[model samples]
Target: MEKSEFDLIKSYFAPLASGYEEAFDLLNDAALISEKPQASTVVTMDTLIAGVHFLMSDPAGDIARKCLRVNLSDLAAMGAAAFGYSLSMAYNSQIDVGWVKEFTTALGEDQQRFSCHLIGGDTVVTPGPLTITITCFGSVARHQCLKRNTAEVGEDVWVSGDLGDSAAGLKLLNKELDVSDAEARAQLIHRYRVPEPRCDLGIELLQNAISRTAMDVSDGLLADLGHIARASNIAVELYEDKIPRSAAFSALMSSSPDLGLALAVTGGDDYEIVFTSDPAQEQAIQELSRKLSLKLSKIGKVVSGHGVRLICRNGKTFLPTKAGWTHF
Candidate 1:
């Protein structure tokens, strides 16, 4: 008796689409488009469910942006540029016409910002929580793409932007902290809603051979660095004092002594780039950051060991209780 929201949204995509089925035709055969000479294609996919990846109370538009950004962060980890993407959505009955419009508007804006073209995807009615799946494809020169297993001893560890913002933002949403300042609260909330993917920085690093190995800090710094250490078969030693902290985060740490800095070190969803380079490339990275107006700082160095060790200024060893988030 009622026109479904899915039908209404499907009509909007039909007119502007090149061909929905044609877009997926390439993927259906289990083969990607042929690679260019001496070039490599980087592909990554991430799925987010309403309650699992986001709160049901969050704005639909913000949820849509998060779905795209988290997937884009994966591409940044390998120093890839966005080429195209596909989205599969499982819509529940609760998706009203206004919600769909807002969600699609945000998705379109992100697609433009990231320079990615949406090919095609399946949308269907579901009986459960809202689910969105995005698969992103990117490209890099064969030798330029940073691999997780490429870190070397003596390589300098670097991170772009301060850590702990996203985790702190979530805490604020849960009302764990009562930050009275509007601007400070807004900054934390922004980190949670729209994570900067560091795509431009990642591409520049690859093009200029700035980083020997790289990974985006979707997970917390300490935990993510541990991943690079494990993957590259090298140990990493980070100076706790050297790790950068945002002004808001610093204030939170000072006020909430029980809320350990370890959360910032081990929390997830920072989405900044964590990379490894050496002394030889340090100047080059610095130059690139200056030219691009990106803040890139060396926080630590790779060592010869199996795991990560945090060295405090007082010569105390700090090991994180948790490594990172596990979907399983």
Candidate 2:
């Protein structure tokens, strides 16, 4: 017997709404939210297509987590705490009851881990590729959310975690690059599959007034930073040597230094936060990083200019052939 859409939702997704009373056990047509007097809701949506955002060969569980986490990354960029998310799925013949079970189970686990819950959503059959869209909602203190345009000249630009591993991982998965080291391969693949959202760090930055301007690094560092530059009406200068990279990524660079460096700056899918803070806040930011046990790299500075500039280790300006990822 084939499971109907309603049956699939009841058996798999409804349980994920367990702790959220407003979800009404997935029986109601809509979910409700009560006002938080001193907070504002932050909503973000991201859609993932099977072939475009992720590989069809990837596990169902990872695909589900990636969909949720990427939206969560947006919330983190705004320094908000995630509360709930509504998900919509367009499934193809490739997805069966077993696949739904695995997908929803992963979402359930991440909900608990991130202190959020499933609120409401829809599911439908698609003749095309399987697609997942998630609209995540979070809350921040009233009038305290971060914005890219708030950056000021002389403020230091900082980025959380390393970059480019996800791009490297993609190459590895596509067989464009071969890494014999088992550990390095696994690390890069994991980074590509599951990006760790800097939720805690974002919250701290906002609540403590450490940074006023920020955004998540989804579209490569250089491209994403360009967004900040345009928004704030300023230029940024980054030192190539200062851009953080994981040890595995650094080791991989040893084989093809130019390619590795380009990938690190121009590769997308790294969900780390890029923010700017006053130089006076430097020690405090460093202390916060130590307390959270997350690496925070001071990579660049905002200046009175138009765009981003990259300085090579040899004291020369480095020009990249490509700025970042683009879908056209």
Candidate 3:
């Protein structure tokens, strides 16, 4: 005899039901609870398809973590604090109890890391690839939240950490790039498998008002910068030499400069913060970073033009054959 679906759901979730209920306490009012009462809520949603966003062969645990992290990255872009989230998972009959257990375990870990409670969600059987849709909710002080359209002329543009790690990591995963060093290979693979959203840096930037506007680098730096440019009605002059790259990236560039930089531009999934600040905030940024031990680097400036231009180290401009990635 086969077990009924209700029996299966109960057996799988029974042991963890109490913890799940605790997490869902925030959802009682159709709104996420916030510690800062005066802050306005910021909500975002992201969906991941197994084949498009991850390998069908990928571990359910990793897929679960990445699902939540990607949503959190959007909250970080708004400089919001992660408070809670809900999820919907669609799995085929091919999935097993073991897979659900692993997926929930990863979700639990991410819930802890992001300081977000897992509110409530639904699980259903589907016919195709695994699909996970996560809705994340966060909060930001009314005056502190950053917007893409808030960029101003003469502000210094900065990004946290290096860009293109995920892009290179994906290349390595696809076997398009060869890494001779075992350690380097491990680093790149980790970047691809697990991206760290800059929550701490984002909150710090908001609290100190160090930036006028901010966004996350997800769909490639140039693509994301284009969003700010379009929204703010201003152009950006990005110094290609200033775009941060990992040590491995520099090694690759030494052999093929053009290809390496192209990967940096067209690649995606960096998740670092891209923000702008005027010179008046320079000393404040410096002081805050020193106190917090966070690394921030200036990469460009807002200009009077319309689109993005890559300026060389010697100040020559080069236009990209293609600006960045597009999802259709």
Best by lDDT: 2
Q: What TM-scores do the predictions have?
A: 0.89, 0.97, 0.89
Model 1, 148-254: lDDT tens digits are: 89999988999888888888888888898768778988998888877888898888877877875888887677778878888999999888787777898788778
Ten-residue region with minimum lDDT total, candidate 2: 319-328
Q: Say which prediction, candidate 2 or candidate 3, comes out ahead on TM-score.
A: 2
Error of 2 at 153 (Å): 0.5
lDDT of 3: 0.77
Question: Candidate 2 residues 1-328, lDDT tens each?
Answer: 1799889888999999989999999999999976489988998999999888898899888998899999999999999999999999998888888888888999998998999999999999899999899999999888779888998999999999999899999989999888889999999998999889999988999999999899999888888998999999999999999999999988877879878877887888999999999999999998999999999999999999987888989898766555443521
Ranking by TM-score: 2, 1, 3
TM-score of 3: 0.89
lDDT ranking from best candidate downward = 2, 1, 3
lDDT of 1 at 142: 81
Compared with the true structure, what per-residue lDDT tens digits does model 3 show for residues 181-289? Answer: 8787778767777778888777878877887688888888888888999999998888888888889767755687777776676577888889999878888887766
